[model samples]
Structure formats: C-alpha cells, structure tokens
Target: MTYQEKKSIVSLISAILIFGSFCLYMYPQYPEGGLGSAETFRYWGSFVLILTVVSIVAHIIISIIFNIVFRMTTKEKEPKFMDELDKLIDLKANRNSFFVFIIGFLLAMSSLIIYQPSQMMFIILIASGFISDVMGSVTKLYHYRRGV
Candidate 1:
C-alpha cells in the first residue's frame, strides 16, 4: 500500500479502537437514571477527562508502532512527500469530514436542547468528533485506492 493509504488505514483503526474502548469502559458505568442526575454528570465529567487522556496516549503509541512497521516493510529508501494530487485528495477528504462533524455537532446541540443534559452533550460531542475523524480517514483511503 502507498504511504497515504497506510496512514489512513492506521488512523481509521485508531479511531475505531479508541471509540469502541471508550464505549466499553463507560457502558457499565452508565447511570440507570440517565445523565440528568448530578452524580452521573459528575462521574461522566471526570471519566471524559480520563478518556481523553487515554485516547490521546493510545493513538500516539499506535501511530509510532504503525510507522515503525511500515518503514520496516517498505522498500523505499526515502519517505515520499505529498504531491499535488495527494494534497488535493486530503483537502477533499477534509471537506467531506467537516460536513460529518457539522452534522454531529447539530445532533449534539439538538440533544442538549431536548434533554437539557450537559454531560450527554459533552459525550455526544466527543463521539461525533471521533466519527468525523474516522470518516475523514476512510474518505482519504478510498480516494487513494480508487486513484482519485
């Protein structure tokens, strides 16, 4: 695979793993009374901070390992830099990703208006951002594979 393709795949996987892990961690802790409870809100607020730190650290470690493996497997003596086409593809992918983010943001805002739970809104915002990143990477990988 090309470097860009590999990078996108890594990013996609990272996003999925991070999000899934976060969900798994929080699922059992989810309040039976939902997010409206003050105790639940406090719990989620602290958990979100912890999750953010964990996700960031995990992604960094995964990225380092992926880069090392990629370098070891590839035959290229030097890493390839992004050309105009690559740049264009990235821009297009980001544009599409931005739309996804906007939609997610709208949904989060709507949820806040309906439920009036700041904690739920925060979680939704984080989830939406993660989904947006995953979509962006997927778009980039698709473009690379399709030679767009």
Candidate 2:
C-alpha cells in the first residue's frame, strides 16, 4: 500500500462517515412545514451551507491527521511535490467528479421543469454533491492502485 493509495482510502472512508453522520444529525431537524414553505427553503439552504463548511473543515483535519500518522508509523514524510503522474490522476478525478455533479445538476433542474416539489430538487442536488465527492475519492483510489 503506497501513500497515495492509503490516503485515498482514508479520504473515501472519511467522506462517507462525515456525510452520513451529518445527514443523520440533520434529519430530525427538517422542517415540518409545507413542502415549498419558506421554512423548508431555509432549512434546506442551511443544510447545504453548513454541510459544505463542515465537509471542508473535516477533510482538512483528516488529511493533516493522516499525514501525521503516516509519518509516525512509517517514518516517511509526505510527498513534497506533485509529479506529472500525480497531476494527471488528480485531473482525471476532478473530471469525473465534475461530470457526475453536472449530471445531477441537470437532473435537479429537470425535476423543477417537470413541476416536481422543490424539496425534490434540493434532495437531488444534495445527493449528487455527496456522490460526486465519493466518486472523486474512488477515482483517485482506483488510479493509484491500478496505475494511471
């Protein structure tokens, strides 16, 4: 297991855990108002905003911790620079992540066009964001393991 592979696995697991725990914590607080009520919009808006902040902070913390642990356990410092292969893999991962998110975005918009409840659009958008994150991690892990 190389460093990149281990880091990718950690990222993948952390993404899942963070998203799951956040969703569980927020589920009960969902507004009980009518689907398109102002309160409902406020709740969903806060949900996305807070989730974005929390996820960014959690990922940064996890990455730092992972680097520290890797150094302590393996006596190896983190890579000092990204070479061509690293850059390519990262680009591929980002491409796939954005692709998935764009598809989700289109679907969410279509839900609105079809006159679906606004809540449905929010749900779809949020789910796509989560899935795109997971997809990026998965892509990195796969590329690291299987060769770029």
Candidate 3:
C-alpha cells in the first residue's frame, strides 16, 4: 500500500475506535432527565474533556504501532512526498466529506427545530463532526484503492 493509503487506513481506524469508545463511555451515563439538567451538562462537559484527551492519546499510540509494523514488514521505502494524483484524491475526498458534514449539520439543525432540546442538539452536532471525519478517511482510502 502507498503511504497515503496507509495513513487513511490508520485515520479511519482511529475514528472508528474513538467513536466507539465515546459511545460506550457515555451510554450508561445518559441523563434520565435530559441534557438541559445542570447535572447532565456537568456530566457532558467532563465527558467531552476526557474523551478528547483519550482520543488524542489513543490515535497517537495506534499510529506509532502501525508505523513500526509497516517499517518491519515492508521492503519498499516509503515515498517522501505526495504527487499530483495523491493531492487530487485528497481534494476529491475532502469535497465528498464536506457534503457529508453539511448533511449531518442540516439533520442536527432539523432535530433542533423539531425537538427543541439543547442537549440532543449538542450530541447530534458532536456526532456529525466525528461522522464527517470518518467519512473523509474512508473516502480517501477508497480513492487510493481504486486508483482514482
């Protein structure tokens, strides 16, 4: 695999792991009274801070491990720079991911209009951001695999 492809794969994996971890960590702690409650806000604040730190640490560790494995297993040297095709693929992937993010944002806005819950809106927005990131990485990997 090319360096860009490997990077995309690592990113996609990291996004999935982080999203899953956040869901698992937050699921049981969901406030019964809803997000508007002061207690719920406090919990969410702490959760966001903790999750951010954990996700950063986890991704860094995973990237380091993958780099080591790739170096050990691969005979060919890694490319030192991205060429035009890699840049094009990245641009296209980002464009597609932007569309995904816009859709997610619209959905979040609609939820706010219909449900009028600040807590749910916040959750949806956060989820949309993560989903967009994952979508971008996945798109990049797809383009790489397809030789686009």
TM-score versus the correct structure, for each prediction: 0.81, 0.98, 0.81
Question: Which pairs of residues have clashing backbones in candidate 2?
Answer: none
Predicted candidate 3 versus true structure: per-residue lDDT over 1-148, tens digit per residue: 6777888988998889887978897889877875578888887777767777887888889877887777788855566688899889889888988888788788879987897776776677677778778888988999999878
Off by over 4 Å in 2: none
Candidate 2 lDDT tens digits, 12-108: 9999999999999999999888987999999999999999999999999999999999999999999999999999999999999999999999999
**Candidate 2 weakest ten by summed lDDT:** 139-148
Best by TM-score, which number? 2
Q: Per-residue CA lDDT of candidate 1, range 1-148, in tens?
A: 7777888898898889887888788788777775568878777777778777888899899888887887788845335577888999999899988998898889889987897668767777777778788889999999999977
Q: Which 10 residues in a row give candidate 1 its minimum summed lDDT?
A: 73-82
Better model by lDDT, 2 or 3? 2
Q: Give residue 9's lDDT in candidate 1 (0 to 100).
A: 91
| Residue 99 CA displacement from its true place in model 1, Å | 1.5
Which candidate leads in lDDT? 2
Models, CA RMSD each:
2.5, 0.6, 2.3
- Of 2 and 3, the candidate ranking higher by TM-score: 2
| Per-candidate clashes, comma-separated | 0, 0, 0
What lDDT would each prediction earn against the true structure? 0.82, 0.96, 0.81
How are the candidates ranked when ordered by lDDT, highest leading?
Answer: 2, 1, 3
